[model samples]
Structure formats: C-alpha cells, structure tokens
Target: MRLSTTQGLGDEPPETNAASSVRKKPDGAKKVNIGEWIDGRYIIEERIGAGGFGTVWKAVESKREEFVAVKEVRHKWLNSPKMLNYFKNEFKVLERLSHESTVCPIDLVRGNGTYLIIMEYLCGGSLSQRLRHSEPLEISTALLITVRMLDVLKACSRLKIIHRDIKPSNILFADKSFEQPKLGDFGLACFKSELLALSPRAIGSEIAGTLTYMSPEQLNGKKLSVKTDIYSLGMTLYKMLTGRLFFDPELLSRAGIKRAILRPFREHPGRYRPDLPYWLDELVMNMISVEPRKRPGDPQAVLDVIERNS
Candidate 1:
C-alpha cells in the first residue's frame, strides 16, 4: 500500500493478516502488535504506509512525546553485510543535505536484526494524490510546485547526489495548510560521484524505478547523470499541467518510450489540455527530450523559464 502524508493524524484501515503481522517492542522482543515499540524509545502508534522495500509507521518517542516517521527495513533483506553497510552509509549522505524543499532524514537506528530510519513527518499528501483528485492547478500554482521541486534538485546537485527516481509520487506536499511541495522518497537516491566510480559490471539487472517516470537513459540501462532527473521533472510538470499521462503506459516499453520522446510536441500538444500556452508546451517538450543533452542543463534554468512564464 502507498503511504501518503496528510494533515492531522488519523487511524488507517486495520490489517487483516493478524497471523503474519509481528510487532517489535522496546525490550527487543517480538509481539503480535509490532507497532508498540522498537529499541525501547519509539512507540509505534500505527502503520502509516508500506512499500516493496519496507513499511513506514507513525511513532512517538516514549520519553519525549515527539512524533516521527519510522521506516523499517526487514533484517533479512539487509543481512547481506555489504548491503547493510551501504544502507548505513546513505544516512551519512542524507545528513549532509539540508534544504527546505527536501524531506530530511532524522536518524538511523538498528535493533533485533531490523534497521529503522527516523524522519521528519510532513502533513500533506503526495503530488500524485493532488493531481489525481483535484482539477489542474492554475499556472501560478503549477509554477510554484515546479520551482520548489527545482530547489530540491538544486540542493541535491550541490551534494553530488542524484535522485534516480523523480516523479509526482515522490514529490510531497508539506501540509494541507502550507500548500508547499517537498521532495520525498530517497530510497533510490545515490551520490553521483560515488556511483560513477563503481564498476558497472557489479550492478544488477533489476530496474531501479517506476517505469512511466524513468528517463530513456534509465530504461536503456545506460549510465545516468543529473540530466536524468531533469528529464523526469520535465515529464512530471507535463503530466501535472496537462492532467494526463505524458505517454501511454500501455505503450511504455523501452523502444516505445524512446520513440515517444523523439516525436514532435505538436503531435500531442492539444491531446490533454487544448488551451495550454504554446510556450509552456515547448518548455515541457524540451525537458523530456530523449537525448539528455537536449534537455535543460539544470533545474535552476528550468525554474527560471517557468517563473518568467508564470
């Protein structure tokens, strides 16, 4: 199940698999309700969200009454000693990044063969949810979202980090009251400098991100750089403003995606939102160019163009 950040705390639907559900408590013992406590400090209030890699829970600090989001990655997956080390190392990388537009990771904890990542809890839903239920945002609102997202990309660039996966689902709203956007889901994030130095022969065949949002280079299993993320953000902007999938999911096989990217913008310009400005259409087309070099050089440049148009 997808985990969404919303304003205010509320209980979610109960899990039906009571037999398989296991809770880890403060004393490092396993219990039926695993959400009770972990490492003797965190009191798991409830399960907030779950994904393929792990589950995120809303937990309270038993002594401080502080609320935090805890992500639990199963020990079995991290048992590969090398994998565990890499996971811990990422926490250090996250700590170096500080930006208003990025959802920060607070700390990392380990207990009873489980690794838990503590993070600040935001109260707004994801950009994906916003786009799904609401009408297309005004140009000004869309620009605001884009600009904030750019800010996030800029910060990551400064740290030599690349968010391999960039999409609407990963861009989170801060809170219902704020209406500001923050970048989330750093699980696939990597330091460009580090990744580049590693031998490609060691990498596995497993694709690292959502299919629809992947850049052509990503789909081809080619080496990626910051430009890869720019292409994604460009596609995200197009989808958010147009209220339609930029490319047909049914036709999203690698070759089809490449061809779609190579096509002229004029062909699909009016398919989603007929009245959209021609300049905006051109901007998105350039952003999603199949050739990474053809896309915007950086997020700042994209934001500058968007702000001026808005």
Candidate 2:
C-alpha cells in the first residue's frame, strides 16, 4: 500500500512547480484532460498547477497503482529546436541524480507536442504554504529543515550542480508530519543558459527564484559557485524562522531591488526576532553577504557550523 501524509490541516494538494510548466501560446497550456490516460499507463486525475514555465497534473501510474506528478511543457517550446534540445539535456541531468531529500524523477515522455516529466508525489504541501498561513516556526524546527536542505545541497555540490532556485515554495514535505523536507524543482537549472536568455515569464518561476532571494553575484552575471545557492538558502531560513520576508521586492523598482540585493549586509535573523540565537545570526548573515567569497565556502562548511552551534 502507498503511504500518505495525514495533513490534519486539511488535504491541500502538495505543490511542485506549476510555473515551471510551459510558455503561453495560442493552443493553451496542455492537451490532456481529467480521466484521460496517457503513455498508456498513467491516468490523469486533476489539474494541480499552471505557471509560465509549465503545467502539472496529479496522476496515477496504473502499472504501479501509485500516485505521480506529471509536469508538462507546451509545444511552443518544442517549436524551438534549441529549447527542445535543452529540455532533453536537462531531463538527462535530472534523471541521473538520486537523492533522498530531493523529489525523484520517474519518467519522461513526449506527447503529440507537449513533453511530460513524471515524478513521485508528496502530500504534505510546500514550505511556502506553511509560511503563508502559520506564525513563525520554532527555531529548532527551522534549523532541522535547514540542515536537511543543506544535506541536499552537499550532494548536489559533489556533482558541481547548483540548485539555482532555493526558496520556501520549492521545498516539499514528504509527509504531513513536515519533517522530511525534500528539495523540489531539482536540476531545473541545467538549462541556466535558457533562463539567462529568456525573461522570468518565459523561463518560469521555479527554475530560478524570485528577485528577493537572488544573490548579488547572480544579478551581476558573475560565474556562479556553491555560494549562489547558499545566499538563497539563508533567505529561506530567515523566512522560516521569522515568518517574514527579508526584502519586499514589490516595494522597489527593478533597479532598486537589484541595488538592495547588491547592498552590503547589515541585518540578521535576530534583527526581526530578538530571541533568535547569536550563532544563527552569525551563520545566516554570513550566508547573505553581498560577496560570494564572504559566504560559506560550501554546504559542508555551513553544516559544520550547525553542528558546532547545536
């Protein structure tokens, strides 16, 4: 039997990257409908998410009698031979990585025009939802989640793969208990070139991250290193621990927002919630430093700090 999360909080569908689905087109998002069977094995159940990059549906793989998430890319992207190849390359990269704290890829399929990526389904909803509805999480709880995500980043770093996007929304709970936080939208940045070449709307929300979490180096178009993800990770932990956003991009114009991210670091987690620990303030603020060299050298370095502080 398949295990499921008991979300006592109501059975809200856990979300992946709906915005990572597809580009807009005259034909619309996708051609599938509820109750339809595709690939001759997986049966579509319902529309779960839709974004600038792609669309996602809840489905059941008849062969395994198990639930799965089907991600779709529209034909508009396929029409571009360049994008089509990039999609294929990205799939290959995602297919190779096997990490427990990351959403696992199942299969990739090519439809009449759309392409579909099948992945394991989770039920506990996303960290973004938790942040949106609940008060600040306990410091211990926030640390636990951060440590697990650091574990994921350590594994990714081994392969020199940078998770360009690290935000509350891309973090998934394996169950309603909310303990197992697996990174979602993995390997979506294998096509960072595509993202840099396209606008946020065209590349989708999940591949990169919102302007608020971006590192100063990323904005400046400097070559990225592990520190890029660390900057966003710091931002995510700040939100979790304080139940607040670090910077409100909406309040600033495009250039203003860029300048804010580029500004020297002057605040820490404790600034918002005085009860936060000194160790936490030191670790997080270091990660959020404007210069990549000022951040932790790697996920392992940050993990070591957590161990020492804890």
> Which candidate's TM-score is highest?
2
Off by over 4 Å in 2: 1-30, 191-208
Error of 2 at 41 (Å): 0.9
Instruction: Write down the lDDT of every candidate, Cα atoms only.
Output: 0.66, 0.72
lDDT by residue (tens digit), candidate 2, 1-310 = 1212211111212223233343443232246677877677788888878643456789898878999987765445545554555555545656655788888887777644456777888888889888886478998889899999999888777777777778898898878876899887653454333334243445443344567787776666667777889999998998898877566666889778777788884567798899988989889889898888889999999999999989
Candidate 1 has a TM-score of: 0.79
Give candidate 2's error at residue 147 in angstroms. Answer: 1.0
The local distance difference test score of model 2 is 0.72
Least accurate 10 contiguous residues by lDDT in model 1 = 1-10
Clashing pairs in model 1, backbone N/Cα/C closer than 3 A: 5-124, 6-123, 23-34, 24-34
Off by over 4 Å in 1: 1-34, 74-76, 81-86, 197-207, 250-270
**Who wins the lDDT comparison?**
2
lDDT at 62, model 2: 89
